[model samples]
Target: MIPQIRSRVLWIVMSGLVLLLASVHLMIGGLDQHEEKSQRLRFLPDGHFLRTASLGYRELTADVLWLQAIQVMGERKVSPEAGRWIYRLLDVVTTIDPKFTWAYEAGGIALCTLVVLPEESNRLLEKGMLHNPEEWKFPFLLSINYAFELGEDAKAAEAMALAAQLPGAPSNLGRLAANFFVSAKAPQQAIDLLSDLYEKTSDPGTKSLLGERLKRVAVERDLQLIEGSIARYRQSHGGLPSRLEDLTTSGILEKLPIEPYGGRYEYDPHSGTVRSSEISERMTLSMKRRRDSL
Candidate 1:
């Protein structure tokens, strides 16, 4: 009985050892296959010549391929299956090289422009920013979308402020922050910021741009003030004035402020309201597109 038990224990131990060897061999084989595949993909047609020239052709090829994939995704009218495939490819590329700024930028642009998902694009930009906090482009893109695309001026102002604080942000970003503040109905703050920027900038081109932006902010603030006064007058009188001159007679406004954009504020007599006549058509279209996509 003791001999039989010893033989059975030896058989079990040998089986276990064989299984462990098989597992290790399989793992090593899989790793070698992966390495071989990576090597083949890393070599281009002129890889030998490029290597002799000391150029990083393999990395450049990866970047070019990333751009091409993003472009195709942007231009194509993709089905769910195609979208999934494209998204997976992008995820793989970004995961392999998290610091590839162009990959992140292209991915964000494609997702926003083609996928029509602002929140998703924002997530991508946020991830990129995590890897590269010094890059101004991600914050700038986020701010522009918040202000113009999302119509959330407060968030836009926050993003613009961050961008302006970054190392290489263009000087014009300060003006963007001011514009965002004005859009959020904080005219005094906007005026203050713009006034400071205009005073500080000495370059002619930058100064001209800042001047135009400040003038626009001033006009928008005046328009809002005039409109509020008109609203109060209507609350008391039960109606708006028939013309701009009527506002003065009705004691609502001392004088009509000329729009800084060189036109009188447009009045809708029937609604007793006024608005900018030359509203940005691009913003209007963007809003419409957003609604349609939703």
Candidate 2:
């Protein structure tokens, strides 16, 4: 009983000493200093190391990190540094769980749309494609990146073709694949693609919007055909035609092309330019007005 009592007292004394030491340490350093140290230590680690540390809970860890990334973005209010960190966080998440399609999709989009980091977005999207080869979203996003960001029509077509091959992808993607073959310069291809999308979509607002796009594309197509015929007539006759009928009269064109907005094709002999009478002023100047809106 004596030995037991002595042992209990010693244990109590030792516990007190340990706590006393911890208190002294905290007092010496100060909470503010400790917090500053912690802040300094909050740097991101390598994603591969994180994945290795996650063991079998990689997906869960990735999800947590993704949430944290989102919170950081929200907190930072889209500062440039936040944009860079978001990519790093997304990379880590995707590295941990390659099969998480939403991470890749959302990450890629944010990187491109919000961050405007095309190269980083393309890298994330391509990585997603490797992991989810059967997913149409990755390739579709890649196609958008190539077409809009990089201005690579052939690459866009390649990606769109991959997307079209996947199940559940919109059927218009196949037609788009063909248009990409024309370097995305053919108005007919754009018109066909828009028509197909319009046909399959069920939303009224979207259909109405697509109707505008269809009309614009049609006008663009008619302008292209008219311009090509005029160019041919110029090449053959060494001058601009006096009127739209001159092309048909000279056998350069079988007949006058139909105007998209139900108006006659207008010819300006002074400037050797062709325009639709019913086209808006913006459309008459450039087709890029609508494209710029995109």
Candidate 3:
């Protein structure tokens, strides 16, 4: 019985070795053209096959495929069609070895920057995040992909928050995430993230800093709501209100949102804009971006 099992193992090993060699040639057939590459991909074993059919040789097969995938991308110009093939190759590699961290990073950057394939990059990085939950780079990359390529700031902030919570993540990641959340127009999300971070962090300095930023964000949020109400009032009444409370009296706000920093809301009747006396405009993201030369 042992001999029979050994023979079966040998057979599976030999078959896997042969298939691995055949699969390497798959990249040679079509890189310059999408249609041809797509056709050749049909012959290559898919992710499921690599995962389930490798006969315990999945790691070896995965390594070989990873090399081929890298080589294909390095040797070719990475046209749109080639990008798709690269995505497939990477998918197969990651499927075979879910813990392959470098594969995810390489694929994430290459797919996003080399071609207009943010969706593919996002999928690969998200899978990396799923498999390697402790690794911060995957979600960091996802945050970047969502922010710059996809223009989804809320998702970007969420991804950055995930990255920030992991060990070895940059300490400023949470701060960056707050900006993204605010830019996403989701001030509550920013408040929530900062609140959570402030609670978990034991460093008093960090907590104090986060407290200040949290109050500032809260102030910004309330001001944004009040500004919107002011706009509506202007449209209906054709002029600015004399005071912030007028909005509440006019049924625009149930009541003015309290400023978190114990400062009153400043209603500029001339411009019809609301500001928080506690949080300076320079402290807000827009002013920061401008100061930073955005």
Candidate 4:
């Protein structure tokens, strides 16, 4: 009976030890995984430091760093801190190999869209533009970031204008740039862009389209000035103007604006609204585009 009790007690103690060891192993594994995930992209030094250490194998260094960057991107969750770290890694890669065009473009896009870090994204793209001036995609991408992400129409127009001037740029870039300028309330800039396009493009259809667009934007510009004067007149007189001429007669406008498209400005006294015979849908299109972007 004594031998039987001792055997049972030993079995129970051994089973408890085995279970305790398994639990400890699982706890250690969980702790290790958590620590590994918590580690962000701080494994690399900055760009300048890596450049000095590359030992003249700059391209090789860049390639290795790029692989690491992609690995982290695939594994980590999208976050601003992670985006910034990725930017740093790409910056190091570019520093080692300035001609790495895809790194600049891809890194910029990832930073902007995935992490919503515009400043870092633009910085990477600007570096690309600096290194590769002939690459129209950089400036085109800049236009997208500025127009849609940052909501800076003038900056977008400028970037898109540069893109349109480059070889192999899309044909619609010019029209889009003009629209951005007009959306920024710089109608003359739009008119100038369309005028430039008209002079350069040999296609008759495109030429005619540019001509019509230029005339329409000019009419819009004049309307903007006239309506502003009418609003001022209403504010001073406490009533709507009876005619378009009332604006100048009331000393609000220096002169009646001439319509650039051989069209006349029509004023509605009841609603105090102004329209042109050459009513361009540019403003409406621009408004819709802005709304869709939001």
Evaluated with lDDT, which candidate comes out highest?
Answer: 3
Distance (Å) between predicted and true CA of 84, model 2? 2.0
Candidate 1 off by > 4 Å: 1-68, 74-88, 184-294
Candidate 3, residues 15-67: lDDT per residue as tens digits?
86776656555544444355465564565567786677666777877877877
Candidate 4 Cα deviation (angstroms), residue 266? 40
The CA lDDT at 73 in model 2 is 41
Q: Per-prediction TM-score, please?
A: 0.43, 0.51, 0.57, 0.50
Candidate 3: give its CA RMSD in angstroms.
Answer: 14.1
- Lowest summed lDDT across 10 adjacent residues in model 1 is found at 38-47
3 or 4, greater by TM-score? 3
**Candidate 3: regions farther than 4 A off:** 1-12, 23-35, 184-294
Check candidate 2 and list the clashing pairs: none
lDDT for each residue of candidate 2 in 175-198, tens digit (9 for 90 to 100): 777777675645565566557656
lDDT of 4 by residue, 1-294 (tens): 999999998777666545533443343224325654234443445666556555455676677667666655554356666677778878888987889977876676666544556668788989999999998867866766676456678998999999989987767778888888886555665456456656766744334434654565577678778878888998899999998888877788878978776778888999987887755343424445656889
lDDT of each: 0.58, 0.68, 0.72, 0.69
Superior candidate under lDDT, 2 versus 4: 4
Candidate 4 Cα misplacement greater than 4 A, ranges? 1-41, 184-294
RMSD values, in order shown: 16.9, 13.6, 14.1, 18.3
Give me the displacement of residue 115 in model 4, in angstroms: 1.2
